[model samples]
Target: MAKIVDYGAFADRLKAAPNRWDVLREFHEEWGYAVRPGSDRWDRWTEDEHETYVRALSGEPRDEDGLEGVDLALPIPAALDEWWELPFNSFTHDSQHYETNPVYPPTVRPDPSGYGVAGPLQDDSDLVAPDADRRVCVFMAENQYCNEWGYLAAEAHDPDPRVLVSVDDDRWALQARSVSEFFLQLTVQRLPRTLGWSAEIYDGEEIIDGDEDDLRARITERMPELGFEPWAELQQDTIVYGGPDVLAFVADGELGGIAFAGRTPRAVLDLAERLGVKLTEEDLTEPGEY
Candidate 1:
């Protein structure tokens, strides 16, 4: 089930407005849509708009979350709000080993107190709201979490909403089919360990070092079977193989990480293991705070 918003109607109203900015301002002030700063595109907005939207959707932060002078216009589920309070390094299960990536952490504005949850929305020229207006990215994982990519999106315009996870910009995987389902998984089931900082499970040590050519050959041979093709240069140390479904990260003649659109975590892990990468207990455990 998709949660649809009347984006067409909203667009229509914006088109009818004598002053486009005024319409956007009204949308922000009244209908809770964040007006993008420095851009006339109604779909685009500042990071503050994202924070505002999250705050408005989730209400005030919890007392223990260290948020003050904040009011809840609409009450969001306590569990979702708790997610916002979690420290940037809180993704790892072990509190003692909660490490933050130096590059990504400084960029993230802590929710409830700083910039709410996510960074600015990425460019979406296709639709005002992607996924048929059913979802909006609320948070992005730190770079250390699967190479500083991926997003935590929430269902919009629905009473019973769910959280979605997308490693790449294109496709999404269901994180929680409903809000209650999300809470249950976070608190009890703990199946989707990749949520928040739990993705550290996949951050294993560099096990095998092959020649760069060998690594490229292996990827050229194996990735297509996995539904990906060589895409572009990632960094001086890395090569990227991209497809509609997954992104393969290769570095130093080793497969560093794989971001999947439709693949299961277990399947990806199995593939990694087959490639000679193994997850040690330490890798699966929380890391020390950086």
Candidate 2:
């Protein structure tokens, strides 16, 4: 599929994609995805030596029958249950970790030493007030160990409910209006960090140069579906372009930065060609995975 920035079409895809787990499973090829702890695909990490110390998933296999051992004070929502059944978690590390669904939680109460599938409020990370009354929220994912994102425990029945943020640990704020938006934001934001695919960066350092605005405009001209809004707020000024075969982003750092990720280093060469991005031998790889 051609990479496009058509905002209308993009919005339509986002609206329909939350319930489609099959879209991810279709990327069966490794695509150089960086392996994190507990991943069955750890070929690049530890030189193929899997991390054996990580404990097994606490509950029975995640399925539509309902998270088998994810027993919580509140009922589980159908949308969450559907997401939990993902064949494989594309994430490998803290940048977008959600590998283990609903970890049994900390051994002790109100102190978060253990994590994954749990929230920061339980550990007193100060996301909210220390003395605040605890609401029955079940966190499903975290970033770098503290920032957490989950649906309200009270609204477990909603297919797509409001998403909450604790920042692995926050005072509890609205992350997204619904699970669908949150998932797209998470996947898009983490694409560059976790997906170890072929890429080319136009880093202006005495070489060729292009301002972020021009690059952004050129990209927008090519894929108008994208918006000026940064996909991940944390990565300020970053605009994402996503498709089945490619993922790219333009951001402001110094002058500007743009990245294109493909199946191999040479894979992005095609993108540079199509986008009319100037490149030299230094920007091209030997036609295979880096």
Provide the overall lDDT of each model, using Cα atoms, as 2-decimal numbers.
Answer: 0.33, 0.47
Which candidate number would show the highest lDDT if scored against the true structure? Answer: 2
lDDT per residue as tens, model 2, 1-290: 23322232444564566443443443323343433456553122242122211222333343332223233344545655454444454542332233323332212112342334333345343434566444535544333434445665445557777766553224556666666556545655554334534444665443244565566676767653432234323223466765435556776644456776654444466566666667654654433321
Q: Give candidates' CA RMSD values in order.
A: 17.7, 9.3
List, in order, the clash count of every candidate structure: 8, 18
Over 1-290, each residue of candidate 1 has an lDDT whose tens digit, in order, gives 02222222443443455642343233222212222344222122357655655664466553343233233332343434334343321222222222222121112212344543433334452423564332243433333443222123222334445444333443334454444333322321121122211222122353333343454566557653311122111221333333322234544323344322112334334444544445432333231222
Clashes counted in candidate 2 amount to 18
For model 2, state the Cα shift of residue 269 in Å.
2.2
Pick by TM-score: which candidate is best?
A: 2
Any runs in candidate 2 off by more than 4 Å, and if so which? Answer: 1-12, 15-18, 27-72, 91-146, 166-185, 191-196, 200-208, 225-230, 233-238, 251-257, 264-267, 274-276, 280-290
